[model samples]
Structure formats: structure tokens, C-alpha cells
Target: MGSTSARTETCKSTSEREIAALFDRWNQSLQTGDPRKVVANYADRSVLLPTVSNTPRLDAAQKLDYFQHFLENKPFGRIDSRTIEIGCTSAVDAGLYTFTFARTGAVVKARYTYTYKWDGSQWLITSHHSSAMPEK
Candidate 1:
């Protein structure tokens, strides 16, 4: 006589719309004008390659510093176009976005990518890269 055991695996799935909404969450955080609120969207081990600065923000403090100055602009972001890719426990949303600074009435059109990971509880930005369009 032989005994066999069966293994059951559970998969977690996230929809494209859900992933897209994550950007809205982040953008709303920016509207708060609090760097800490914006930083809360990121994982502890994350990287931010921002649009306005050459420095690569690798840690919380660095990210906080960058956002402190950036938030001063009262930036509001809108996605121009985007593509979302879903993976197991991870997802990537990359696209073009435009930011309008309320303080200066300045608009910036940029190409951006946000890589997110499910940290067992919530999706957090693992890496965020944004660069201004070079043509103009």
C-alpha cells in the first residue's frame, strides 16, 4: 500500500485596471504636498530616478530629500499614455505623463516607469524612473 499527498498552490492575481489605479494612489499622495506621504508609496528598498534632478535616490532619506523640494512645486500628474504588465507578485506600469506645477504654471511632459511589488500586504513602488522629453 502506498500513500500519496497532493499539493495545492494559490495564486494572487491583479488586474490591469487595478494596477493602473496604483498610479492614481501615488499621484494623490503627491497632491498632499507632504514628502512623507509620497514616500509612503515606496518600499524601503527602492530607487527613485526623478525627472528634475540628476541624483539617484536610493534610500528613504534621499527620497525624502528629493520630494521635499519637488513637492514645493505642487505638482499634479496626469497619464498621457501607458502600458501595464503584470507578473507574479510584481507589476510594471510605464508610460508618458505630464505634470503641471501649480506654483509656477510650468508643465513637464515626461516618460516614466514604475515597477511595483506586492509586499505581502500592499503594492509598493520598487523602482521609479522619470525623464523629461528631450525633443522639447
Candidate 2:
């Protein structure tokens, strides 16, 4: 008989419905019109490639900078198409979305992809990439 040491690892799994719910929560956060609240959805080590901004936000301050101006438009986003992929402790939601800006009464269609990670307690956005539609 051989003696062996046993180790245990904790794994987290998320469902398709749950991933959609996470996007819902993120959309709801944007409705708050508070940049801080919007930033809360992201992890400290997160990246945001915003729709309107040319800068790639790599830190909280940069993300806050983008959201500060973005929230001013009072943008409300709705998913037009969604494809969700779930993995162990991570997920990606990629699709098209439309944003209606109340301040300017402008409707912008965009492509978006959000990657999230389960950080022990809750899901946080790890990477967000969004771009406006190029077609006229």
C-alpha cells in the first residue's frame, strides 16, 4: 500500500440563464446613471474596450473616465442578439445590442462581448469589448 496526500479544489459553474442574468444586472447597473455603480460590476483587474471611446480602459480610473461621459448620455442598452458560452468559473456573452440615448434621442447599434469570472462570491466582468456598427 502507498500513502498519498489528497488535495481538494473548489470549482464554480454557471448556467446559461445565470449568464444572461449577469448581463441583465450589468444593464441595470447602467440604468443607475452612476459611474461608480457601473464600475462595480467589473473586477479590479479588468479591461474595457468601450463603444464610443477610443481608449482601452485597463484600470478602474480609466473605466470610470469612460463611464462618466457615457452615463451622461443616459444610455439604455438592449440585447438584439446573444450567444452565451459557459465554462468552469468563467463565461462569455457575445452579441449585438442597441443603445438608446435619452439625452440626444439617438439610437446606436453595436456589437458587444463580455467575459466574466466567478470571483468566489459573485460574477464580475473581466473583459468587455464593444464597438459601434460600421454599416450605414
Top lDDT prediction, candidate number? 1
Q: 23, model 2: CA deviation in Å?
A: 1.3
Q: For residue 56, what is the lDDT in candidate 1?
A: 99
Compose the digit string of candidate 2's lDDT tens values, residues 66-119. 999999989999999999998878899999999999999999999999999889
In candidate 1, clashing pairs total 0
Q: Looking at model 2, which ten-residue stretch has the lowest summed lDDT?
A: 6-15
RMSD of each: 3.5, 2.5
Residue 89 local lDDT, model 1: 86
lDDT by residue (29-131, candidate 1, tens digit) is 9998999999999999999999999999999999999999999989999999999999888999999999999999999999999999988889999999999
**Per-prediction TM-score:** 0.92, 0.92
lDDT of 1: 0.95
TM-score attained by model 1: 0.92
